[model samples]
Target chain A: MRPAGFLVALLLAAFAAAPASAAFQYYVFREFGVAKEFPLEPTRREAEYRTPLLGRAVPATIFETTEDNMVYRFTVADMRAVDLVARSAGLYAECIAMAEAEGKVLARMPQRVEDGTAFRVYGQLTSVDLAEAGGRKQTNCFLNKGWLYKVESIVLPARGEPNAAAALRFSTSLRFRIDQAPDSP
Target chain B: MRRIAFTAAAVFALFAPPLAAQEHEPLEWQEYAYPELGIAKEFPASPQRQTGKYQTEVVGENAVPSVVYFVDFGDLIFQMTVVDLRAPEHVLRAANILAECIFLAESAGLPLANLPLDVKDDTQFGVHGRVVSVDLNYNLGVRQTACLHKDGRLYKMEATMVHPEEEDGEAIARFVTSQRFELRKP
Candidate 1:
């Protein structure tokens, strides 16, 4: 069989062997005293990046991977460097600017999870969206436990369809270790 | 303005926002679908559909056709209006819905107030709307309307009732939550 065909068979075999619930892996961040689950292994490098809105350098751990033509990115930012992100105009403006830097904003909605955690979903309209015919851009942010967590995923029809349900599941699985539970916000 | 919506939805309006939690008992909801608009939503009962037309611009002579699907559950009325605006120039025309809403309240000889808070109620299918509230009229109660633009079409949803209580607020949230817009392939 051709190499491409063989790879498809291998991928299928792997999917058959993996349990449905084990699609994501969980990790515990000791320094931050937070435990969370992720879809892919954490990248080996830690990087400092500038937030266009906040205008400050903050430490960020990024997990990025591509599968079936879809791009997935998950970022955890330690916001301890600056004052708390006051739910004010500045924070709102920063969020809008950050999410829409490359594409026109399609929709932006904030949700308050049942557990009292708040999150916002930012949708961007992009050219690739019209080309892919079914592509969508979503940047999701959850502000909780003194950290800002973001999950971004793009759905391209030519690739496998993106799993919004799984993305949301992974994001909601964030937990604080028992040791830090006493002071967790 | 403080962006964080408070339970101080208490201090600002004397009532909390319906977006946060469904604090009331669930009502029997029936699925409502509008194929002409390519959207479906859950409503407590069958809604009354109203069709009308208004000028896209206050001074323009062209009439923009519109439809409103609404229902009243006791003291609250939930309404959704779809305005056909496939014309490229309709972008600016869509915005006039807000002022049109204001004009409507004033024409009825009622005092209306604008709440600067922007509600973040966007569906997963990519429709976002902006919310504003008004005093409406003596008997009609308060009105909160959200306007959304997509595919050269304008969708405006409104929740209006007189003297809304906590239960009414929860019901309004339910109405907003149940809305789902269908994005069909061309």
Candidate 2:
């Protein structure tokens, strides 16, 4: 009994000393519908609002942050009255042109997910040396519901397996729904 | 036994040729030194002004010029000229020419999208949009502009892009509207 008690105490101490893990939080909103949580340190930093083209409003929320250098952004758009496909295509074209002008090479092509959402991933080479923070890579994801287009941009360090793992985890959390709903519980 | 040994030797001689001679050669080495491509000279300073909506600083100057301008809200870098065109009537025409050139470049397989061109009569400025298309379906969100002052004396053209989702279209338009140009004497 004494030996078992000692082992249990040691395990508990080890668990307590370990750093807290970060996770991407997911939310569903009635107006914009579905968005994901980013792994950012402060929960408040994850939320942002913006007005897009044609005076449409969008609100983005972050769900998770991790040491692996990954952050997630979830944006909900209200495009019920607009042509969703044309708007999304035009925006996609616009984004692609800008990236090319900046001399950023596309590491991966746009891939369609099983659930009918399309996303494009890109990697940017850093202009300055970042030996300490590792190299830098950026990934962008685009999703459209009717006239509403949601964009997610993630910046990752070139090195560090932890960052890559965190980025993959955050990307897998994307969920979309057509019904209008609020994001918070 | 001796005869058999002699026959074997002759057969071996016929089957094998003498080993080829080996040669050794020394490596030739050369040394080279490159001349420095000296630093570029700065552009002539612009005259000081008491008040203006914009200010221009010569960041780099040479055959290829670069000027940094500070507007009301943000700053931009320009690689082209910031000159004073003598005629007021030529300002809009010059802007239209630049816009057409950009459009032609895009149509010739350059990935430029969402091309927005507008001439503001009150400010005498021309706003244009440009993007560098990447692959078949990816772009960076950048906008370019050509500003002509109301008097038509100053003309400045610029290329600008927002960091992904940093600011929306309305914010960008507001920023563009507030731009002013400061021309330097040649």
Candidate 3:
């Protein structure tokens, strides 16, 4: 009986030693015609989008990740401009202001890269440390053919930076509907 | 005779002045009409009136029913809308869905704030008024309001202020509630 118990414990230890696979999931929000893949399991929530100024459809998809317990949001809007950089700069200012208002600091040395004439990408690394709770977050803003597209992910645990990696991957995978154009003002 | 004539001319120039002098005076206030709002209003006539690009239009299909009017006031842009919910169930669903979406957006660090509902009792429409929401960082403000009338039509008002001001609240509220919708085929 002692030998049998030793064998059982050995089997349990071996099973636990096996490499565990990371949970990865993907979600597609049809209203915005955008898809996102996350490193951890996320719950889906539906949202209605409305703006008083444009009165345009502002539908969104929200994903709640498990590890950092951070909510990821995707929003798309159609806007037109003669110059892409000007519009992108305007959007970046708005995003930064919004982030600051929520008590999140803008990460220094943001990554900036050019995509094409119609699109440009910029990202930041942010952290929110409170007495009770603390976490790190990353946000990416995509300017596409007069459309302002944004994706943001947050991760808890100062060391486990899942959101930063996910945000980079998501930014590289962004695509837009060709038919939608910015509404005339 | 020459001295008399020069003196007479000098007196005339000093006292009579010129016809152009009257033009420099400020213009008086004049009653004007905003045909779109269906109300006659008054404004100072000094500043020349310029035609603006802003206009009113109905947006969204039956799947998403809303009407919007855009007005350009110099540097600011004002948008007003009337959303038709059609039923009580629609209102309840919309309210919850909108609230959740806003919360999710805010959690992601978007500039959405001042979310609240407006409920009141009246005769034509049992409930009316406006609910205010804002994206301060974006300099965007939204007002969502609703009413249920005896005609069995549920109406909602959404007013967006791109360049907001203190008086915008009252202006938007008045514009939204003053709207009249047809219950049946017009």
Give the residue spans of candidate 1 off by over 4 A: A1-22, A82-89, A100-110, A113-134, A162-165, A176-185, B1-186
**The candidate that achieves the highest TM-score relative to the unseen native structure:** 1
Mind giving the per-residue lDDT tens digits that candidate 1 earns over A54-132?
A: 4567787776655444555666676643243322122333333355443544544333333222211222111223233
Span of 10 residues, lowest total lDDT, candidate 2 chain B: B32-41
DockQ of all predictions against the true structure, Cα-based? 0.01, 0.01, 0.02
lDDT of each: 0.52, 0.35, 0.40
lDDT of 1 by residue, B77-141 (tens): 78887777666444433323333433343344243432222323233224333344566655556
Q: Write the per-residue lDDT of candidate 3 for residues B10-105, one digit (tens) a residue.
A: 999899944331111232434444333332323223223333221111111234444444444432333333344335333323322232222233
| Model 3 TM | 0.31
True contacts kept of 1: 0.00
Alpha-carbon deviation at A158 in model 2, angstroms: 11
| Fnat per predicted structure, each in turn | 0.00, 0.00, 0.00
Over A46-137, each residue of candidate 2 has an lDDT whose tens digit, in order, gives: 34333232233444444333354444443443333333222332233333333333333434233332322222111111121123543433
Question: Of models 1 and 3, which has the larger lDDT?
Answer: 1
Tell how far residue B184 is off in model 2, in angstroms: 40
- Candidate 2 CAPRI classification by DockQ: incorrect
lDDT of 2 by residue, B94-146 (tens): 32222233333333332433333333222222222332221122443345443
